[model samples]
Target: MSSPIQRVRTCRDRGSPMMTGRTPRMVAVLGVLACAGCVDRRFIIESNVPNAQVYIDDQPVGAAPSHSSFEYYGNYTVTLVQPGYETLTKRVHVRAPWYAYPPFDFAAEVLWPFHIKDTRRYYFELHEATKTRTDDLLNSAEALRLRGQTLPAPERPALPKVKPGAAPIQPVAPDAQPFPQPGSGGILPPPRQDNPLPDVVPRVGP
Candidate 1:
């Protein structure tokens, strides 16, 4: 009986020292480091899309970690990509100045068939030449010295000012026939005579 009691006491004594102590010094030390252990971690966000790449400020940030949440703070460029869809590049911000960081919780909702092939033939030189002509017309002041550029125009053409609440001009319908303008030298037609016939007009009329 004495041996069993001795064995139980020895087992209790052999338990972890971390669980055994309740000293003032021990409690103070635990309190100081507890913040590191209990700090709320932010999630590194990622979506399961094929061939997805991430970019920030036109620079790539490799593939996102599939495990745990993304805990980055500050502005970010979030992009999700699949072969069939257009490379969706969106500007995202995950900033929280207070505390370690806020919890990361964001998910991408995938959709299908977002873009068509860039098959439209485009020429940059043609566009550049056209732009040069347009800019030359709009930017005539560039031909002068810096100080002389802002001089008042020699001739100021009078242009009609559009009034507020003006009626909108609409295009004529393609199938519509043009009618003679009312009150413009055309004879004034009589008012439409009300039908004197019965409510149910006879199919065989005399």
Candidate 2:
């Protein structure tokens, strides 16, 4: 038989307190409570072009008036497509909320009792596609050419042939002498003080 004191010690050891008995449940509840503030941010994208397909970062999200969610803030590419309209592309900048910053984010992730959500709306304008008049002008020009109504090529007068300019004659110096003929003796005749030939010669023809 056990002693009275020993029996009392055993009974006390067997009796579990509420704190130990509910430890797991209390932890789970605390975890759920701490995560309550974790939330996603959302934004709306709208365009004036009705029924235009919307795309974000090349992924088709929805049509105009689309609602999107993001976990963090950053830039995104938006594209709009519609029939008989110019495709529109633009860059969208989304800024982080106050709670997403360092110190605030810590509280928002762990301590806040409820989720905080941020929503923003954006609108865009799309322009219609325009037709170029170049093709019409070209077609008209080609039809005029085939009908021989085009302007005739103007006749160009023949340009006169320009003779090469004769080389300029150089002036003879007083002391310079003429070159001797090849057949004549190399020595030059002595200079005469006066003319030896007759001044006038009778002509045979009248």
Q: Clash totals for all models, in order?
A: 5, 0
Q: How good is model 2 by TM-score? A: 0.58
Query: How far is 185's C-alpha from truth in model 2 (Å)?
Result: 42
Q: Each prediction's TM-score against the native?
A: 0.25, 0.58
Q: How many clashing residue pairs, candidate 1?
A: 5
Best by lDDT: 2
Who wins the TM-score comparison? 2
Which runs in model 2 stand beyond 4 Å of their true positions? 1-16, 133-206
Candidate 2 lDDT by residue in tens digits, 1-206: 99999999887877766557899998988888887867667868898987788888898878988988866689998899998888999998888878789898889878887877788788989898887689889988899888786668789999656558966556686766787999887888688656587788977996
User: Against the unseen true structure, what C-alpha lDDT does each candidate score?
Assistant: 0.47, 0.83
**Segments in model 1 whose C-alpha atoms lie over 4 Å from true places:** 1-28, 35-40, 44-72, 97-206
